[model samples]
Target: MDKITRIIAYAKTKLQEDLTGHGFDHAQRVATLAHQIAKKEKAQVDEITLLASAYLHDTIDDKVVPDVAEALAQLQMFLAEIEISAKQQAEIIFIITHMSFSKELEEKVTLSTAGKIVQDADRLEALGAMGILRTAYFGGSHQHPLYDPAIKPVVFTDKTEYRKGSTVINHFYEKLFLLPKKMNTKTAYEEALRRQKFMETFLTEFYQEWEPEKANFF
Candidate 1:
């Protein structure tokens, strides 16, 4: 209804069509999580901006944005059209660029509350049944295995190992499981618990499926 809200709706619809850990379904789920946490956090953060940030967080994701530099410039220009100020635009870009687990060790950047909210929202999607589905989808897309019993997730001694790390499942152990501890709000923390249990259950089932004795149980 409002100007920013309209920008958000249009941006989301477009990203949903072009982006994916699978598709728009994933974006909607993340957006819902953002709204849920936003409602529960009761922080002084702007709901419109926070929700907008969440919905568009992955607009320029490594997987989504084909030409990273060009996409980013286009993204900044797009935000300009929506009447967000330069500082507010910086806040949104800072959150998306710095909040990623993949790049967290590469660079340490400060976050705004809006950025934190979006970070929490996006990470939450990587933790539940939804998380499992997205991981398998992305892993399959990237030619990574569904699970690799031979290769255990390595504990990083440094960022290099973390960057060139193991399969996508390794990402769950290395990062998603650790996210709840990093949550900036009570709302995000509580949601993390439910999703964490979900990921745990998923790993158990996935491993079980690979074992001869448990293979047919499903």
Candidate 2:
């Protein structure tokens, strides 16, 4: 198989059974979004590198693998076998490693045009209707509470604090609501605004349903 086809097959195999929202479907969606954004931006980005990074972004994530170092080593070997250029491999790895929201929250990292497009696409997945479903799926898989009035959202200063979230509803305030402003590309930024508005509507309806008695007050 060609390298791109092989990478897609590998990603599908790796994420086929994932229940925490980082499944193959999510990867595919991100890859598609990245490609669309790249074309729309008409920037001097490497489409192959961006798409490859999108497909493999979560493969070696600590959230998915018990040993990130080992997973990444294996990924490097796979890239070498596929005969991807060293520079392209580096670009893909750089985008995957730095694209995560938690990583971005922790430190500022500059990205190439390709990296920026991929990052925007990945972050876009964390908004809108799909974002809500993914959040619910992840929360359910992890046994996190759906909602709790007393468990207010906390401003996370680090990845640890972010992951220690007690309720899924708090995620809106903590991250989802903030993603629109963080988008890297103009096209994605506009799309994010629309999705962000949808999330707001969903949250409003959710609160009303959660407490019909307090709906008038809201």
Candidate 3:
């Protein structure tokens, strides 16, 4: 099989045990989204690096892997065994390690075109209908509440604080709603805005159901 296929298989194996939204399926969707965004933007990018980063993004994530150092070592060894050049491997690692929202919450790193596309794709996954479900899924996996009016969402200036977790509904304001403006490409921004609207509507209905007496329709 080609190196990209092997990389994808590696990611699948690593993410198979994930109960959070950052599973193999989510990685695959990110890859697809990255491809679509790349095409729409007509940006010159290293397609292999973009696809590999998209598929392998979560494999070494602290949220997924028990030991991130070990995971990174193993990933590097695997890339070498698969004959991916050191340069390509470096590019792939850079994209995955720096693309996440939590990482950006710490500091924004300038990205290559491929990295930007992959980043936009992953962020897009966190914005729409799927984004809503994934947020709730992750919250449930981590035992975070669905909502708590008494506990408001706070602005997270760093990854550590962001990972401390928040209510499912609060995640929309904390991260998801902010994605559209953060998108790297015009195509991703437009799509993200559309998805953001959907999530907002869902939240509106959710609030109504949560407090029927206060619902305007009542």
Please name the candidate that would achieve the greatest TM-score relative to the true structure.
Answer: 3
Ranking of all candidate structures by their lDDT, best first: 3, 2, 1
TM-scores of all candidate predictions against the true structure: 0.85, 0.96, 0.97
- lDDT tens readout by residue for model 3, 1-218: 99888988998899977899999999999999999999989988887888999999998899988899999999999999999888999999998899888888877899999999999999998988899889999999999999999989888897888998889889999888888999989999999989988887998899899998788574
Off by over 4 Å in 1: 18-22, 156-165, 214-218
Report residue 181 deviation for candidate 1 (angstroms). 1.5
Across 1-218, the per-residue lDDT of candidate 1 in tens digits comes to: 67556756756665766523735566667667777777677757766567666666677776776777776787788788877778778777777778777677677676787777777878788777877777767766667765676888766656666645578777788777888887877888888898899789877876776685867774
What 10-residue stretch in candidate 1 is worst by lDDT? 18-27
Model 1: C-alpha RMSD to truth?
A: 2.8
Q: What is the lDDT of candidate 1?
A: 0.73
Evaluation by lDDT, superior candidate among 2 and 3: 3
User: Taking the tens digit of each residue's C-alpha lDDT, what string does model 2 give over 1-218?
Assistant: 88899999989988888889999999999999999998898877776787799999999987777799998998999998999999999989988988788897788799888888888998899999999999999998889999999998888879987877679999988988888888988999999999999999998899899998988765
